[model samples]
Target: MNIIETNLNFGNLTKRSRTVRAILHHSAGSKASAEDIHRWHLANGWAGAGYHFLVRKDGSVYRLRPEWAVGAHASGSNSDSIGICFEGNFMTESMPTAQKQAGKELVAWVKKKYGFTKVQAHRDVQATGCPGTNFPFAEIANGSTGTVTPTPPTSGNTYTVQKGDTLTAIAKKYNTTVDALAKASGITDPNKIHVGQTIVIKGAAEKPKPTKPNGNTGTNPIIRDGQIHARNFAMPGLGADGIRGPRTKEAGIRVLQQAMNRDYGAGLALDGIWGRKSEKALGRHTVRRGEKQYMVTALQILLMLKGYYCNGVDGHFGAGCEKAVRQYQADHGLTVDGIAGYNTFKSLIQ
Candidate 1:
């Protein structure tokens, strides 16, 4: 069994191109790897993962859609560019510490690798709240122009969703218009937008879109590769229903922990190693746990002890575990299925 897996095989790499222009930042609603992002784009019907690369919360980087493969990450600009999506949603909040540095490093790497003239945020090119308010997209782009070090987006430039952030108010702050922002985001009503929802104040430049009568708006364009979609991309290697819930997290955590204990001799920390500590330990612990489910059973025990659950420890899952699962599900906005699947496990231990 492989200690680590990669969907991107340079063997089947798409031919290199010189037209790579900009890098777009996006959120996965949580932290994810470039491999995970690649899986997500494939699920979204994209050729591979929409991003050319991905940066994890801990700054780990993985190549997703190769530079030559057309990516569906950006609208009206898939044919001749590279798309980069950092895993966590930067809107409504700050990204994890590791991811923040990782984001900067990845951007710099892409610029050097491709000689991209410009670096733009997903919001800058399209009317959306992607790349979030807190992300330093503008600074990234500006710094790329001449500075050696990356700069942060200007202060007071971020706007947290408030009880009442009227379109007019938002426009005034960014010197933009409500209608333009709404149209870019595909929103029907400005008032209907909710608190904590991210919106782009700096609008995107319109690219030449594929034209057809009532032409496909290409808002959710995905390539059908008979794989999974981002909306359903919680677990891939592990057969699962595509939601990113607690089960997924829990399972993922266990998989990582077992991998760590094998080589390390002693599993110093039982935590899923979602961060740097366990990642290093995993190298020392490379022994496989025989079966995936058995590894998950270990994770279940940890979850129950956290008081996040009261599920009894059992080799086979029981209703006691199921009920605790349901409570955990409800608290974290899961499907409430008694079965402990990918999404359920992820949320449970993460």
Candidate 2:
């Protein structure tokens, strides 16, 4: 499969630690580019576009986010999953043959690269249906298309002559001069052309440019910077100096520990270590709508880190926080009650 590199800037994104599975998704729309999605995600207050790759209907695969970075595509599974989003809503429209075939190849390539045995749909991990019910999850995940190299869009700008077509009429149809068309088609006698003759049009659509590879191996040094670490771990008020120092990471952990202490009254030391005590102290405390607490702030921060919009990490569990909680629950296979209980907290923190 031809993976097209993009120059879209995704300010700071977290690097994923491991690759255990590939998650498939649909754009839920008929037409969109990677850049369009990136803008949408930025509006939602995310790092950038959530999916790592986007497969267009014409079989063009564009790299959106870095393939190795943790994506916002899946809620609980983002840290270890690679997300591949296909263009168009499968629930309403059929996927083109070229797009489907390309998807299979991409899936196969990722599986081979990471030794991945698990390929899942959005609905499999999240509560809501996505990639839609009509998505060909089985066929793509099976990767039966084999190693056939994908054919790029055709290069020739030729037109076929119909029964009543004339050289003058053909040139007009293609918005070109008759002389230019005759020269391009190598027709010395333009008026003497017979039916079913192929005529090349001058100044028609140009050949699509070849895409460049991103040269990413998942270990790029840019993925290790402090800005990404702070954003990945959701450490608000922690300045990311662009340095990948130990203190930056530790400070993020400390923020989480402190939040738990203030909210849950877990009397453990303010150590950055997320050990068994912290886990045990995360009791079955539930926070829902119409409540304001430190736990709500922590919940909002965690939700944002996982790629959900929480309208900023304020200590208020209002409508936005409730909506984010419900989304998180739905995405993580939890009960969708819009409540951040023990199970929700455990999923977000651990």
Candidate 3:
């Protein structure tokens, strides 16, 4: 329940007109850290991490962006809403018990702070599959202050279909049979029920017992030690040791740069040097001549990903890079400045 201040360098904050709603989102990636997300947002030309708060699987809530500033989570709701993102791809995995509790507590905290009543999923505001289907919207919406329990029968006696919901699943949830549901709701085509479709349950079932807490919950390998192990595996010649000395550190970075080029087609030089070219390639910023950074290399890779014919991920902001930028800008209806600025980077990352 403790909120850890990340002290992230978010630069100047943009004042929000008002806070009306709280938006929930998932990272869509497992074992993500606040620093990792901050760097990703920075690469995308955002001032800092997009979410006002980030909750980890271990129930650790990190204050990322300031609550008073406009966030960049939902497309159109940033100005009036607070964004709360949790780690894990809920699309493919159920939220762990700790994360679930933490999310509810965080929502409650936001409610108290902003005096907001509505909590919405990311997909509720946009066309993207963010926050994912497995997100526990009902548990959050009803101000449930405890761990996830079996949802009791609604007083209204109607159930709405959600994404990834199946008739069999609904029947199981309501302690009834699909045939009974079909008969009660006159659902001739049980499979045709779409999201938001209402179906009536004949009668309320007995409340089920609360499930036991999972002992292995919140055990993410990537956050534990897998990332270091993977890095070691990637540079086997470095003895797979987790030491970062001056000699081994640069070599490891070189190996990573090469790996990005080989795996993601980053087109970085095979040289074992962490220069501006490598920085630009990593989506840090657009590089200019006499300035080498990893962001330039990232730009080149993004251009290549979009089918713009960049010669290589060389980390140089040259004529070819400018041309590619201009082409991308024109295609995306951005100002054709032949430079990758905030808008350009946003579009590229998106």
Top lDDT hit: 2
What tens digits encode model 2's per-residue C-alpha lDDT throughout 166-224?
A: 98887765555788766655455678775535665423213311223863221212212
Off by over 4 Å in 2: 148-350
TM-score between model 2 and native? 0.44
* C-alpha root-mean-square deviation, each candidate: 20.1, 19.6, 21.2
Full-model lDDT for every candidate: 0.49, 0.69, 0.64
Ordered by lDDT, highest first, the candidates read: 2, 3, 1
Worst 10 residues of 1 by lDDT: 222-231
**Residue pair clashes in candidate 2:** 127-330
Please provide TM-scores, in order, for all candidate models, with all chains considered together: 0.37, 0.44, 0.42
Per-candidate total of colliding backbone pairs: 40, 1, 17
Model 3 lDDT tens row, 59-132: 76777886657999998889999999989999998899878887887788677555679889999999989888
